[model samples]
Target: MASKPMNVVVIGGSLGGLMHGIVLKRLGHTVRILERNPSPLLHNQGAGVVAGNDTQDFFQHHDLTHRSLAVTSHLRHYLDVKGNEIHREEYAQQMTSWDLLYYVLRANFDRVESGYCTLPPVQDGEGKATYQYGHTVTALRDLGPDAGVELSFRDRDGESGKRTADLVIAADGGSSTVRKLLQPDVERKYVGYVAWRGTVPERSLSAAATAALAEKFTFFHASGVQVLAYLIPVPDGALEPGKRLMNWVWYVNYAPGSAAYRELMTDVDGKAHAVTLPAGKMAPRVWHKQKAVAAAALPPQFADIVAKTEQPFIQAITDVLSPCNTYLDGRVLLVGDALAGFRPHTAASTSQAAYDALMLDAMLRGEMSRQEWAARTMEYARRVQRRGVEMGERSQFGRHPYAGTYPG
Candidate 1:
């Protein structure tokens, strides 16, 4: 399909990297995915994701199994303090869980055995894809002229090696090592809030809670807080009733550097993390205090969902927008959150990754120039990043600066 098959190296084996790898490999390019994690990434720290158009389209085109991936909600409802619905709208959205998507993608890309997908990897005689875990990229070098880029890496066993490819893709996420190496001045800007997130088994919830949240996108907003709940597939992608999970996120403001923020951000081992405190690692005392707050502040239905959660986690909201995603004369590129990290209000992170992968596919197919692709991708990133910030400001700070100017 292409003028010539190019060797490709993808850093990070998460959604963004896997999407790019799958697309390029299908186009007859040799691809190698180096993941820092030492094992199969079957677990995700966060929960449900709204399956936007880009995500749906990517699966339709690339995923071979063509399995059902989401649970649909046909109604949207807003709740008051008493848990009574004050506003109702007919809205339909497909909700997907993080683990389901990850394993499905992995099954499609490399056919790693998992409960999500049991099919073997497809052998289409296009190109070969190799996956390596426990490889941490240590440095990057761009050879001059037609030569490609070289990357040095050390594995978990402290063994170091190097590889070169005609192109390099950095999908390492918000705290990307590749991004930091290229743009040392860029950093993650913390917003004045954090999200408390957890999931409860549908059967574990009370009848009242199930009646309120089942098959409905539910939300509640207070002066400085916003909470939402929706149903997603279980860990193995089961969507049947009573086998699903009710995922909820409550956004609460805590000023940076305050004692409250410090106490909440510190994990059970007394270590501080800049972004997420993963499930099952949160300190008991911190979780209890937040549960007490939920009892006092949240509506009864929402409060019950929180109480039933056994391992709630916290994600500190942060934003990062790089000036550009192209680097090293276009030999290296940054996509997804590495290019522009959005606030969670937009719920467009996975969609952004899908969009980036689609655009990269177009570029590799000679459908667009590298310059054009870069401009289009950066425009999309900035627009989504701005919209996420505006939405967060409106919901968390009661500001309507972008009321009539929201991006489509």
Candidate 2:
């Protein structure tokens, strides 16, 4: 009455892949996570992410704690550049620090591996799983048509090795090497806007300034641009008694091929840096312009918070989607940004990753055959990917606000 254990290999040790590995391991499978980072400490572990009830269900189902939830604030008002208040909607949901979520999930995963047992605890075959950091998967090749999947990777010491698994899950993010190998024609397109983000201590501002940002999400809209500000309780503690941090994002339209665009995308030393800009290197002066714009165009209360911040970071917004009907290839399946990278407008990246994990878990449990799983999961991905593409198209030229009506 015992079921055989499945050997599964997951590429990318971030949220989606880690979640998939955890769920499969729980279902009596031998799961291994191949992480390219040197170690767990080197991961970026993003700033903050938003999630709704459906996402919360995934966390709760996996026995995760809610204590790590960040400060929740409702969107109170949307104001135009002239300080005129537009629509006001209340979003009653929870906000959380992305790093906190990753840490919590990672901790829970470590606690679950006591000693895997067979389906009915037969005297043979207990499942075992491992997380192998510094293993960068380089190639994935089909092993005939019946041998399942084979993965080639390089370890920390630059040693090359190969692995075979019954299933392979690729959650390697936007510039996913797996995706590039499988589907060469698909590419990432840059939107005409750059997102500048930073955080400042609440105590850095005066009393009036702090009150303006107190426990509420606020957005300031302008023609072809928008700025959003919110208070997120750091992993350390709450907002009172000392000081909490306020996170801010400014969307500015930058012509793709102009000099200013090149300068804005340049590195801190004024040298041309290739890929997207990394965190915390933007010159203070460049961000000063954004603060000045906010001060001149937004409500005085919101402007005051902007003027008090220091050392903001900038990133170019780009859109990437999978080619038609190809999110999966044989035993390897793509998830999260690996499959579809969306504009930040919907704030749905984390939620979508959670959904992928849940659906994939069910499929691995034999609830659906490999063919059925690929069809159903790809359909789900297509729907979400379409929404993301529409959002990206609307967000092009930087004409939408976080609180405005969704463009059809």
Candidate 3:
């Protein structure tokens, strides 16, 4: 176990990457985060996060300001196929949007200027952590058994550079470049379905709809499909009623490698995408067709929510199972989506990244060996991946009145 500090470069700048950078810096390492984005992140515009325990721990441990970034609901409402509320149970959970958490993490990371609407960081430290935006990581290779790791990078100015770090942490997300380099044979398998997601501000809804959804976690299940709706802070991470928004996702199945799948990935410009079509980039015809389906199949409440949304997006759900996470004589490591992409059903990806960071920090501080860290992380990834699959499959559950809607 080595307690001495090391230079670390983290690829990818999303939640996973940022978390790793923060955790590593706290453990006394010099850390730099490479974000492929050309500029600072645009806050308050990302999808919602369920905020599992591990996710919460990262914020709590870092002492970041999070209380104002999330919204809480104490009731769970289950609706019928027609969108009629059939049963209600007391539930308690706190959720935040990805934009909010990202900005919060970014603020604590370095002296970079977070955008206009970001909440101030709860704890600002020595500023040992820095982020390099517009820098894309090209490749990483070890010089020799003990000669350190070399990193190749390309900046937005069309200039290229190289650097060496004692450790390389690849948290570049599910479509990770480092993961592709290390495990060339692995692929993100499309899980035969897609999710249609959107958000409508609370003020945009009717009084009845507002009353039904405000401060509530809600859902509706259909044959091979599931619809979930919840409230989240609005564009500025504000919790004021009118300023909040109702976000929803409808998961519907489609065959992988099918024409429908390819068509769904098509953008407004007619360019076919390999994965998601960003908000407002979905061809109008596709959203129009989905509106028609919502009108006929979804509960009236949800149908209204979908109809009023101004900027909806589509994401193709995919997962990967990577059996190994450490390489280069344990000098290089993979974390978060790079190690293994899991079905979102577990809501574990963010939390898992935190756990990975925490565990890695501990091991580097002499709590465990690199070999043990690799084995434990690999086992944990497989377990979490399998659990997500099981949870994704058992889609229909809860109060019995809606059993008929289950996709048998």
Candidate 4:
């Protein structure tokens, strides 16, 4: 154990917050994760996440459940518009549904029964991890050096409460409230594009589509569009053949402030979303138009997969990087997407969260100082963020020398 145990408060009980909370809890610190979402389960809108190296390493080190976490694909195929393979490579990738990752992390942290993870909670001595849902942090106060920070929040009942912690982690995502409070000047820049994403059940894929994509990470790149498909574990965390999900993402440019952008962002109820239009909420005409474009531009297999999808979502791509991550005398940290939101081309967001958590662990264990930890995390964030921008530019605009390859 360390010389002192901390009372840590993690704002945002998503992947980033959970990873940090779990690590701190295992190091004998008491952790409380405050999540704004009132529901016991947070939905990822049927999206898939790349299980990068740090993500896998995090589970190997911190999660005691030791469950298999991803669906593996050992081949990559770049197909022409006619569905014939233009290029094939022996590349392996691990993919997981966002729901699976959340359930697994939640199981390891607070042992919340989400049905997806039925394994018994692992044992840790002296440390406690608790999650409070429907809590929105409203204010933060620093009490001088080494004196900890206090947070004011409103619960689901609209009741207000205050909590103080030796350390506070803000992993609240790209549009982070904490970040806005601390660094008001920081902003996210839209990348003039959005991803049209959807998933079909493996069993729903036709024989030809299955044969082309079942075990391969498949891609079809056009002039200004790129679509890729791969398998991911299903909602219930099953990875068996025909039980997985065939997840696909198509990147298409939509110039900011254009009429096309406006229509794409306006949902079924006429609510205009700033970043994401979730599954089942997209306007019918908008989706119909996109589907028509897919049919004309995408490979037959890719188009079929898109057509079979019941509900598709849209995520507008953006880039955000904070000048610094640590604040309030090292008692508060802006972590993960809160610190740096990258383009999805890198698929490094989750891995960035894991990396941040592990670096925090190292700091708490006296392997590094707080300044060192902050610097290291920020450096990694910048590198990945830049690479993501380059990769997106290369694929969508053919403007960069960077190859159209994802971070493995």
Residue-wise lDDT of candidate 2 within 168-204, one digit each (tens)? 8888887888888888888877778877776677667
Reference-based TM-score of each model: 0.95, 0.84, 0.91, 0.95
Q: Please, what are the lDDT tens digits per residue for candidate 4 over residues 1-408? A: 137888989999999999999999888899999999999778888999999999999989987667788999889878877788878889898998888888888888888776676655557474898999999999999887667798999999999999999889999999999999999999988998999999999999998899999878888776677889999998889999989999999998889999999999999999999999989998898888777876777777988999898899999999999999989877889999999998998989999999999998998889998889988999999999999988899888884221243211
Looking at model 4, the pairs that clash are none
Which parts of model 1 are misplaced by more than 4 Å? 120-123, 399-408
* Whole-model Cα lDDT of every candidate shown, in order: 0.88, 0.67, 0.78, 0.88
Write down the lDDT that model 2 would get.
Answer: 0.67
lDDT (tens digit, per residue) of candidate 1 on 286-334: 8887888888777789999999899888899999999999999898999
The TM-score between candidate 2 and the true structure equals 0.84
Total clashes for model 4: 0
Question: Of the pair 3 and 4, which is ahead by lDDT?
Answer: 4
**Full-model lDDT, candidate 3:** 0.78
**lDDT, residue 217, candidate 3:** 84
Summarize candidate 3's per-residue lDDT along 1-408 as a digit string, tens digits: 444677888998888888888777777778988888888664333477777777777788863444566788778888886557888898787877887677777776663445524444434333268788898888887887656799999998989999888888898878888988889899988777887888998888877677777788888877677888888877556877788889888887878889888888888898887657788788888889888888888777888899998888887888787769988888788998899888877768888898898788678778888888888888889999998877666662233344335422
Error of 1 at 328 (Å): 1.3
Report the Cα lDDT for residue 245, model 1: 96
